[model samples]
Target: MTWRRALSVALALALALLLLLVVYDRPLRLMPWRKRSAQPEAAERRTNRGPALATLGRGKGDGVDLFKGEPLLGEEHIFFVETSCALDKPQHVPYDSESGLRLSPRGACAVEAAAAAHPTHRVYLVHTCDVHRRSLAKDAAPAYALAALSIPNVRLWAVPYALHFVGTPLQGWLASGALRASRWPVVHASDVLRFLLLWKYGGTYLDLDVLMLRSLGEKKNFGCAESPAAVSVGAFNFALDDPGRRVANACIAELLDYRPDLWSYNGPGAITRALKKVCDVQEVLEMTEEMCGGFRLLSTSTFYAIPWQNWNLFFTEESSEEIMMMIGKNLAVHVWNALSHNTTIYTSSEQPYAQIARRVCPNVVAAVGDTM
Candidate 1:
């Protein structure tokens, strides 16, 4: 009787142990703060991140490929664009994004500025489509990306903006069938991607035209003022898990609710609408330190020292000592590249932008090599 009982108990224990092993095999990693997924990028992300990730709080976005937006040593600075070809569709192949993704010399200067100014921060040049490292070396815009990639803290994030990561409130709105695919043009698509990046990663966002002259300093949450009366999301900083980002994530859902003129529907107008309500201020310029986006409104002199209308002065005017002094005061300079991209100019040191870029972000000019 004793032998039979012992054998029976042993068999029962074996069965229970096997079942426990099977269950625990998958669930054991869920025990505590550790969350490393099967993907190599996830592992790399884990190794690459530092104190900033701890500061960001690894509560929700711990696993999966979708959560590629991880924190590194310092802060993440994001930049994005949609190619003219990608505007009308949901899915974007690499070719669709190549046009705008390629970096011109001026665009490269912008990248160099940010990377050099905030050497410790993680600078991410995000794009939609497949951009190869070799391919980037062949052209002007890609030279910027390649140059930026040369830095340990800088990387390129090539996620298919609207095509992938259909998890945001903005994606839900897009899928709601409010507007036909034709209505979602490149400009609108770009705007949509920018909001998603801010909501997901919660870092600073900048336009490709901006050149950082100095470190962003203590202020971590703010947007630049295009004018005394208007705020532009061109140069912006928002922390990860920020509620204001959530508000922007939600507000941009109405992107196609009513289409206006191109710029009004997708560019500054879109940001104006979202930030106004999020910051709880009627006038963007009137927003104060206590306010949301207004908390750190960098005046036009801070970013857009020369307004768009006077964009020519950047090229025509020489960098005399006095002008250089004024430019030095600003943290970054927006060269108004959008307005000037098409206009041809013999890029030389005589141009204020080229001069400043050469001084602050030499890689941009170096990337140009003998061509410059």
Candidate 2:
């Protein structure tokens, strides 16, 4: 009697376990397993079956893919164009945007100066920002556009800016990664910009926060400003001219393709991934910190030094004044104070006011020049 009862209980337990496993199989597949999915691969084929731009950044309808298939990193124009093209939409206009379509006078001036300074170089205003400033009303943006039109050498490109909702799939993917988990969304965006720029322009990537004290064309080699090894490359401030572009582009492409997941939240990982592809990257690093794109202040000789407070200075200061000063002297400041996003350029003297920037960088002053 006892044997029969025990056998029956064991059979029931086995059946229950089998049922549970079957129920969870599909859900487990939904998780990020090492195995590849047949779905995304198949979908990619279906969606991309027709003729497509050789790259994802450059979409159709933006005129000829003159830069198509040809590497993007070395050519500044292609970089700007491709990035602008990828981000350019007719303006979807997000709901929470506080500022509308307005460009600060200071911002306009900088664009003008950039264009005039580099007439042959194809200067562009690559704006990765959102919509809905009371200042940026429909009427206002047009005025900004008009001002931009008047600027001799500059063109403007914009993305309908919005906060990266942490709950979204992309953000979630980033947060889940081991390498990317430490960084904020802004870092992710900055890295994305790097890939975009490297893929598109490859010459030099300026963090939007940078004030552009002067033209960076003079720097011949890879310009890497100084920060810590962890934060140094600044990816934004970094510059990769003609040859480096090819290396960076191939490296970035490989990283994106091989570990698209790493691109999710890991800025440094993306950079690391790119660096791994090049054999002589160190020689390139030796050229100029300015080209490397960190906090190398623009001067007669490019030196390696932290801009002001990008990495750790902010942590020490009770007030943000020091940071503001850094923002002022440096063309861009990493405004990564927020937990979830990277720092945006201090275009205005609003809260987190870059008063020092107002004083030193005329371009910064000019962008917000109209502000009192």
Candidate 3:
């Protein structure tokens, strides 16, 4: 063939090869996936993998001072920003003088109910002050707070607005092959800052999107579960011990000064890793399908379940309904996809989740019902 013809043939082959690579990339990554073994020996090793620290009530040791020095339970400020991604068309849903938006009710209820259920445990709702957020309009927080106030135990806190990052500086320098690529720094920073505030003030941290079915103290042990099918420990419940808090604070502080990469931001991962080195991981209680529908705090050999994997398990139709019912059974039905709901609850906003809470956790509902 002529030289021009040969060049054209080579280009066509290269294009075909590139297209083939792209098509098969996902399957290739998914194939040959190893199932994690749940051997008894492995579980035992993981349980005791960390060093011996001071023992707490649940036969778990509280070693090293993670936080500077602080109390574990108190008035925790729980904030859920309707991240640019999570919100729907509304700038902010209307807050009737009576009830709140139906979108984030369950999460709001969890904080409010948990706070009311345990007076010693205070939970304040925190919202990002960023009004010009890409997705939803501002006032969503205020609307949410109005509904939450009806619950008696819930309080509201607001952070000064800050600009949302398009991407952290660290992304450019890091290779996709590196672990840091998976990290979400802006979101992590917000979460970590909240935790720092909780630790410094002596309280707990909770994501607004999650529902609380049982008492953290009752659960005792801390291990990640795959949510929906299993709840992964992302930035969820943890007692604010000095060392743990310090580790969290240090992680965020370090990110601000050093890495400047959002992808490497692992708040819970950092604290859990540090604690695992010195403390025993307690027995992970299973949040079964009966109580967890698609989501449950699953039993894993590791300290916490992987969030991405666990949440992906939540997307299926089978997983979603199962998790919803389970939440109705064990905890309140969370409805993580609350923003998707289009109806307005005008009379009493808390009624939907409250009805489920009454049915599932009757005693808790009875106790807090009058308050509501």
Candidate with the greatest lDDT versus the true structure: 1
lDDT of 2 by residue, 74-156 (tens): 33441232122122242223211233333443344334444544555545445455333233422234443344434434434
Cα-based lDDT at residue 240, candidate 3: 55
TM-score of 1: 0.70
- TM-score of candidate 3 against the unseen true structure: 0.42
lDDT of 1 at 149: 50
- Each model's total of backbone clashes: 7, 44, 37
Per-candidate TM vs. native? 0.70, 0.44, 0.42
Tell me the whole-model lDDT of each prediction, alpha carbons only: 0.59, 0.39, 0.37
Predicted structure 2: lDDT: 0.39
Predicted candidate 1 versus true structure: per-residue lDDT over 1-372, tens digit per residue: 699999999999999999999989866645332454445363336432211111111125421122233434334555544344343443433322232344466666676777777776667666554444333333323454455556555555554444433555556656654334435455565665666666656677788788888888666667777876666767776665455554556446545454633554665666666667777789877666667643467677888777888787777655445566767677877877668876544445566766786787677577666333
> Can you write out model 3's per-residue Cα lDDT over 117-188, one digit (the tens) per residue?
455444554443323221122233333333444344443332231312213333332223232232443354
Query: Could you give the candidate ranking by lDDT, starting with the highest?
Result: 1, 2, 3
Best by TM-score: 1
